[model samples]
Target: MPDNFGRYFVNAIVAGLVGRIIGVVKTEYERAKVETAAKLKGIGIGVGLLVAAAAIGFFLLGVLITAAILGLATVWPAWLAALTVGGAMLLIILILAGIGASMIKKNKDLTPQQSIDNIKAALPLVD
Candidate 1:
């Protein structure tokens, strides 16, 4: 009976260690999932707000262009005033689009490179 005591003790220790490890892994996974969901929600809200702001800005711009056309109509023909306003708006749009495209081209990954570097640094330790 005493000879089996050591075997039972080792088995118990191994089981406990595995159980603890599984518990820790499950907790960390749940935490990561919740955090990721929260971050995605925040990003969605931010994008929605930005799109709303852009829509409002465009509406204001349209109003201002109409006002400009009306103001210019007092001096020139209505058609010429409209054409001038449209041409200026087109020029502004082109310039802004070029800048936006260049910025997009220069953009990097959204994920943090530092975190990836840290993970890489830790991987060698595992071996």
Candidate 2:
């Protein structure tokens, strides 16, 4: 009778531990799902912005080219206006590119790295 009781006691303990583990895994899975969804949403927004920026950039290039041509025909010599406009546009593009690079650098981690590490740490115990 004591042997049977001991076996049952160990079985209960094992079952409880398994249940707790399953609960933790479920919670973590849900959290990871939510994080992945948010990351995808952010990526979509970033791509949309990039497309919009490219469209605006093309429009600006057209306007600037028109301005350069007008300036060359009316106000300044051809070479001088072309050089000035080209240099200014190049500098502005470089500045804007730098700003965009910095912004991307600051928030580049799209993965839930902290959660991943936490799960890795917990995995041994689960095993």
Candidate 3:
């Protein structure tokens, strides 16, 4: 009888531990899901900005081509206008790049430090 009782007690202890472990895992999963969504959104926005900058760069290429053709003409004013537009396009590209750089930089550190802390709090090391 005593042997049977001891086995049942151990089973009960194991069952409770498994339930707590499952709870902790579930909580961490949900937290990670939310965090990942936010991070991905930020990354998507940054990528979109970069893509727009590339498109504008291509457009600048066309403008440069036009400017080169214009330079072949006899007016200094046309060359001046081309340089002005080119300068403006370069500035725009720089601004977009800066914004995208900051965004990507912000998202680069994706370690779940908060999750780590929570797990540690939930299950402290025995040592």
Candidate 4:
């Protein structure tokens, strides 16, 4: 009877350990899911910024072309006016693109690396 009790005790301990491991994994998985969602959201914002930059560039260039030509043509040559407006528009685009690129690079990690490391640490045979 003592041997039987000892066997059952060991089994209970192993079972409990397995259950705890499963619980940790489940919790980490959910955390990873939330992190992925946030990363995706950031990516979307970065893309939106890039698209807005292009759209604004084109719209402003088109709208300002006539005004710049009329306003600056009196002071400078028509060609020079157009050139100035084009350069300014290009500069605007570059600045916005740089900001958007930085954002994209920042959120580029879609995988939950920290969670993965935690899970790896918890599982001994997962190496």
**For every model shown, what is its TM-score relative to the native structure?**
0.56, 0.68, 0.75, 0.77
- Per-model C-alpha RMSD: 6.9, 4.1, 3.0, 3.2
lDDT of 4 at 76: 58
Residue range 1-127, candidate 1, lDDT tens digits: 8879989999999999778656655665565566556555555555554455455558557756776867666766665556566666656555555554444443322444444444445444422
Deviation in Å, model 1, residue 37 alpha carbon:
0.7
lDDT of each: 0.58, 0.67, 0.81, 0.84
Candidate 2 per-residue lDDT, tens place, 42-119, comes to 555555555555665676687568767777678666646665666676566556555555555544666766566666
Model 1 residue 59 lDDT score: 59
- Tell me how candidate 3 scores on lDDT: 0.81
Checking candidate 2 for backbone clashes, the offending pairs are none
lDDT of 4 by residue, 2-80 (tens): 9999999999999999998999899899989988988888888889889988897887677567767676657656656
Order of all candidates by TM-score, from best down to worst? 4, 3, 2, 1
- Residue 66 lDDT, candidate 1, scale 0-100: 77
Clashing pairs in 4: none
Candidate 2 clash figure, as a count: 0
TM-score of 3: 0.75
